[model samples]
Target: MTLALYSGNLLAQSHEWTNLHDEELRRRAVKAAGEKDLPALVSLTTAFLTVQGKSGVLTSPRTVEAYELGVRHFVEFATAQAVNILRPGRHDAQNYINTMLAAGRKPAGVHLKVAAASALYRALRWAGATEADPFREARVPKDPTPGIIKRPPYTEDELADVLDRADTHAKFLLFLTAHAGLRISEALNLHWDDIDEAAKRIHVRSGKGRKDRIVAMSTSLARAARHYRGLYAPGGPDHTDGKRTTPPENVFRYAEMTTARYHLSKAFKLAGVDFRGFHPGRKYAGTRLLRQIKDFGRVAAHLGHESVDTTRKGYASLAADDLKDDLAGW
Candidate 1:
């Protein structure tokens, strides 16, 4: 396999290469790939991968592996259509979509693969490889369309029981995610510098779009954060600071997503909570915060959402009490 590296535009540096219009660029990119220009192929693949990473879609290494699988499928389709991977035409893309649907791939799965392929073509075009976007004309299947999957939230009683049963770290993370409405990635990437103990705020420097925002911390979350801080303090026994005198940059080291999920799941199980995963912790958190604060704008800001509409879409489930109150009026 030819190793792909990301270096903006590779063909620009080649003396034998000539910059062409979109039409000719598409033809040349396909011709060069047919001739097996390893560097060109690598550059094209790397460019798309880089875009995926930047789009906040590829959050973990596992997701990247899945993207690679999608890439492989696209390459195979392009080869079968006798087209270059970078400039497969609309007909080729449409045919590939049909083939995938016929192969019994789930609509959601097919959509993801198609989106990845489309992104790849866009990147190739951006890099001056293609003229037209093949995906623009590709006919994606309409039925069984993919949509966002939202997990159910834990009940208030169940949430309390889980917190009551959780260990210090698990409890802390739970409160941070549940009450504070921090995404797992945002919470994991948090450092000591991001926290303001006196002010009871956490600064999110790099979030979904690399946007920075400050979120208010709950009292319980503040206390737990301080406790976590003590664990990393110099001379606090777990510290690696020389003479235990200096602080580390990060509060948690090598915080794997799997481990965090396992611990939270175990805690929920022990507490007899019905939740099967950690995302519900966030869902419940957002819902509870909205109810307690009764301010959509505040909840959106706390959750780092761009707008209140997004918060409502994700967490606006009516409670039994709400239904009961409405029925009373009838």
Candidate 2:
């Protein structure tokens, strides 16, 4: 009777003493945080992000968001094999790293996943749920050189087909990405005042890495922008609540990236072309400009790259075989 009472007391007390049955590392991760499940984990993540922001360790919401994304991605990868979140060893870390590497993702992309995995480890430790740091022995993967065969840029014809079929707002947004080589965020964040139709240049304020640049517009892009601007003049979709509004402040202000993705996909379906995600639009632009300009330095300047090497390595860099045709001419 005394032994039974003791056992009951142990069961009722802190769960850490008991060998808990965790399903696929999910329970272990939550329980390690002294949490019940995913909700608790999310709550812990939010709390951690808030603390990080307040402490100035990570002041930007965008940075915190990136961390959160990394956390979720890591959790998905690590929990696949179901390790003890509280007692995860080096093997678990290696598994995640290996799995990510094996997936053939670009090194830059894999680096984000690895950093995110590390962030989750930090969160767990900071939450006082577990002192375990599974990623302690984690190693970063190696980045590979860029080649033409790698991540084949979408063709101009594909872009044209999709552009012709897109809705009014989508056309302007996609035009910037496809022709101007603006990132999706850059295109969306554009203001009407930033457009210089006479100059034929689109000012990309705060592009990737917070760098700003101007992208010259194509004839088609200029025409599309003029058409969209014409709509902005009267009671158009951009100016629905027209109450003394001079012009729409942000060009694609009402357009959401998610909605744009949907529209792009729909347009591709209608055009009978395969649709990759929007970044391919940037790739298409870069490759086209590189070929037309035939100079990596010039292409880099046009694309607003901080370095010519980046332009050469990413957009204009051709594989050894791809340069064979030019070699014959040489």
Candidate 3:
């Protein structure tokens, strides 16, 4: 007979987790147990499940799997260093960094691993497991991975050419993402309820770090959305019976990342634009908005950045031309 340990009431005192049903509890347990013998894994997993669940992102299976994998990697590193299962230290973190280097992990991959481990340490600390955060002392190598290089902004003529070549729905999605500075995930996850035609704004309920903000929609974007809506709406003889009415809660699911890549690759080759994908479009939008818009705060709000500094860092390159023009005038 196998004895099953009941891990109940761990969250009984916490109002946030107390109301969680059976399915949520089981999911949390499974995620926590993914790692081998990180003594506080169970508690850390519970914390993640609670926090992310409240943030409305815990429903994404992919996100949960990524968390589990990250936890597993940390556990493996901790075990190799003979770190105390419940009380890891700075030396353990150092050893893990050396081991990762020895295994030929790239700087970015190592950074992610270290960051993930740090998150786990923080989680464990939150759960009353230990006082030390070994990751605080875990030094990332001197040569940190370079940030992603911003691609050149698309010229107005090039943009027109790409739009003309793209399919109708693809064009609209591309325009929204590139012109509006929406992330691919945010743009793809948009629903009809989020759009306010009269207000000329779209509420981005989900953003990076689970923050919410509203972005003003361009007239072109609003028009395209209305057109897309009409295309998806049921009408004519097809809806005579009235039973096949389109659902009010519909969202456009065109051009997923992989599909977008395939189609955009073909479009790029045909247009000879040397552009790759939608991310460049976002960069273009950000750069253009920063350069053309007089107010940094408004630009930051439109792009849903926490601060103007983030906007500056992302869009500073766009100012080079303005600087050149000023020098010429001087």
After superposition on all CA atoms, what RMSD does each candidate show versus the true structure?
6.3, 10.6, 7.3
User: Residue 293 in model 1: shift from native, Å?
Assistant: 3.4
* Runs with alpha carbons beyond 4 Å of true place in candidate 3: 1-46, 49-66, 76-89, 98-111, 126-132, 141-162, 196-200, 209-212, 233-248, 254-278, 327-329
Q: Pick the candidate with the highest TM-score.
A: 2
For model 3, residues 191-213, the per-residue Cα lDDT tens digits are: 77887767878888767666788
**Candidate 1 lDDT trough over 10 residues, lowest sum:** 7-16
Model 1 superposed RMSD (Cα):
6.3
What lDDT does each candidate get?
0.66, 0.65, 0.61
The Cα RMSD in angstroms, rounded to one decimal, for candidate 3 relative to the true structure is 7.3
Give me the overall lDDT of model 2: 0.65
lDDT (tens digit, per residue) of candidate 2 on 116-230:
6666666566645577777677776666756444666778687778777888767887788778877776776788888888789988885765677888999988998899887
Clashes of 3: 0
Q: What lDDT is obtained when candidate 1 is compared to the true structure?
A: 0.66
lDDT of the structure predicted as candidate 3 = 0.61
Instruction: Give the alpha carbon lDDT tens digit for every residue of 161-236 in model 1.
Output: 9989987668878887887777877776777788887799989876766688988888888888888777764345
